[model samples]
Target: MKKHWSVFLTTFMSLLLASPVAFAASPAPQVNAGDTAWVLISAALVFIMTPGLGFFYGGMVRSKNVLATIMHSFFIVGMISVEWIILGYSMAFGDDSAGLIPGVIGSLSKIGLAGTAGQIVSGTSIPELAFVIFQCMFAVITPALITGAFAERVRFKAYALFTLLWSIFIYNPMAHMVWGGGKLFALGALDFAGGLVIHILSGVSGLTLCLLIGKRRGYGKLPILPHHLPMTVLGAALLWFGWFGFNAGSALGANELAANAFVTTQAAAAMATVSWVVCEWLHNGKPTILGAASGCVAGLVAITPAAGFVAPIPAVIIGLVGGAICYFAVAVLKAKCGYDDSLDAFGVHGIGGTWGAIATGLWASTAVNPAGVNGLFYGNGGLLVAQIISIIVAYLLGGIGSFVLFKIVNAITTFRADEEEETSGIDIVEHGERAYSQSIMTGESLGLPNEFNKMN
Candidate 1:
């Protein structure tokens, strides 16, 4: 009896000693309240940007196509939201351990968010659901940004199909490559927010699509002016407000990195605004509100990739140069190239994103975020090379992927509206509605006047 008791006691002690190590090997994640709240709030902020973008683009288009233009952004919010829930999130962030082409895309292990419940993100204290929702907002807005390129000319059905396909093929793979431990991440390229993934991809794709879709009827023959500057200004304000979330939220925590990003975002935007207005004043002899709004956006785009890696001063220089370059692209390059990018999507986003990416390589510093490496000015040229390579890859993916998707969409249905439809108005032809009941200029009822008005 004593021998048996001794053996039992010894075995129990050994098991107890081994339990802690076993648990330590796969410890459960702990949630942080502060981090979770910040991420959720940031997600909400990004969600509003799509509608804000609608108003911005809608105000720039002719009055006859305003509703149709706005519809593009609004509808995408619904369409892409559903797509993300179903498969987008999985393809964008799922583990690639089982992928046949590892580092290019993700596996479908998390499809429909199957195993996400009660799970925490790998490096953060937030729940996996929080990350999914935040990224969903990004996926929703990217394709919507493309609408500005072919506004007032694309068939609604064709636009819908192209956006869905583009999200699946272009946006998903790119997101994985940059943020999901894929090829770009493995290659040590840094994109703090989305210079290569969002701005460059959408901008270049917009350029390709606009070229393929042809110009709006009378694009060069007639003057195409914005119908509502106030609305556009309001839209710009919303975008500016939301951008703090876009840049800072990328930090994934409410910490010093987030604070730094916030400061840099403001500094870059302000400097860009000043530089753009000054440049316009010098070149055109006057500064326009449109120029100010466009400049601010350019600066925002240019600073996105470097927000976390750079200091506030570097951000300002980036913005100053970015605003001027984008202005030139819109004002001079568009005119010289003779391509009708209806709203300068390529000019501001593509050009700004390219500059921002290269600037990241030029100005990035480990001092700002120890996770990141130094850039050219900080005594490292390899980062600059990486940035250039990423830029080239982005251009190729955006241009080639968009071309193929456009062709497929066009084959399924006529991509561009007919000449008669263009003249009559896409709002009425595509949506059977008008933005306004009466024309402010003529005081006349718009959109095929009612029988009583006709009789009058």
Candidate 2:
């Protein structure tokens, strides 16, 4: 009741402020110290998540492929960073892009950050440059997420090419449609952050790559254990830490909405962690640290879309749903489908993201944010319908788009490494390097032949 009153008062006040008299007296938008600082800091936090993801995924693959796995995420940071300022950012956020299909892509007007610099972002206090760098962090992580699916057997050069193309064709357009003032935004679909743009897109793309690239050699035939568990836990910690910025920062201001998002983000992540461990304990007789980590991430993904529009309790419910749903996706569904989705990227991020988006429609409240709509529980089912539509669109596009991108990339050059390279381990075969120095110490001690030691 209090929240309802608050929403009513806020709305009433907004109307009053928007009147003709208020418009003339209102101060011009200027740089806001707090919002700018928070957003920039949030960008930095998000930047750390890619390497953290590398550690999380790296720890899950076999020791021989750890370096290769880490390299995928680490290198995308540099690759996408360049791509962003070059043309990627323009394609994503450029205002003038009424694309070939209107709202599907941004204009190339801002290519190379051409005319966008220290100028203020429209309706925001931050400089255009700040928004560019902040969004670049998101672009970097999306492709890195796909690397987990095709981890060991992928040719690095081919993977690199795919990353370039995927960002251009798949990621950039999707980002534009949702957050870039594109069709979805125009249609009233509300994505506070990037449940559709990032998670769903990457998850579907990850699955597509797995099918196109084929499974890692000896996938189900042999148990491939994590080379290191502690690294994964550390990576999860970093991801959770970074997500506060990802969720809260999306508010684009250090205001009540940002505070709400911050609190909801933590609540969802914590609840999901508990729910995941509990779910695993009941089913498997013991809950592993991996379950806990996976659960937390699932929770984060689930709450992202709802962070600003729902209260803490709903966030907890979203997390619980995410935890259980993702567990089933990875454990039961993956086995039945026979796809080796290494690290369960499709299960965790994809499923969690979809659920989170729908949950937004179920739990969102005008009371929490008048700028947002009420959800089904709050007496509107229309938002839920839009959420479903966005989910379907994302899956279809990500799947079909990834397939085409793979065909194009493969026709140009082979995407998969040869059998000999796979057998020898990708780190040594492709990079001429090892993840651990201990391999070197043990190599000479074992008295292996010089040719064998070459790892090729």
Q: Alpha-carbon error at 290 in model 2, in Å?
A: 1.1
Q: Write the residue-wise lDDT of candidate 1 on 1-456 in tens digits.
A: 999999999999999999999988966779999999998998988888889889889889887788998899999999999999888888888887765357877888877889999999988999999999999989998998888899888889999999999999999999998998889888888999899999999999999999999988777766678878888888888888888888999998899999999999999998888888888899999999988988898899999999999999999999999999999999989999999999899999999999999999999999999999999999999999999999999999999999999989899999999987887778889999878754552124445434222211
* Predicted candidate 2 versus true structure: per-residue lDDT over 1-456, tens digit per residue: 999999999999989877978667968668888888989998998999999999999888777788999999999999999998899988988883455456888888888899886588887888878788889999999889888888888888899999999998889989998888888877677789889999999999999989888887767765567778899999999999999989999888789999999999999999999988998898889999999999999999999889999999999888888899988898889999999888888998889999999998899998988889999998999999988898998999899999998999899999999888986789988899987775553244578665434331
TM-scores of the models, in the order given: 0.93, 0.90
10 residues in a row with least lDDT, candidate 2: 447-456
lDDT of 2 at 260: 98
Give residue 438's lDDT in candidate 1 (0 to 100).
47
Task: Kindly report which residue pairs in candidate 1 clash with one another.
Answer: none
- Residue 393 error for model 1, in Å? 0.7
Q: What is the C-alpha RMSD of each candidate to the true structure, in Å?
A: 3.8, 9.2
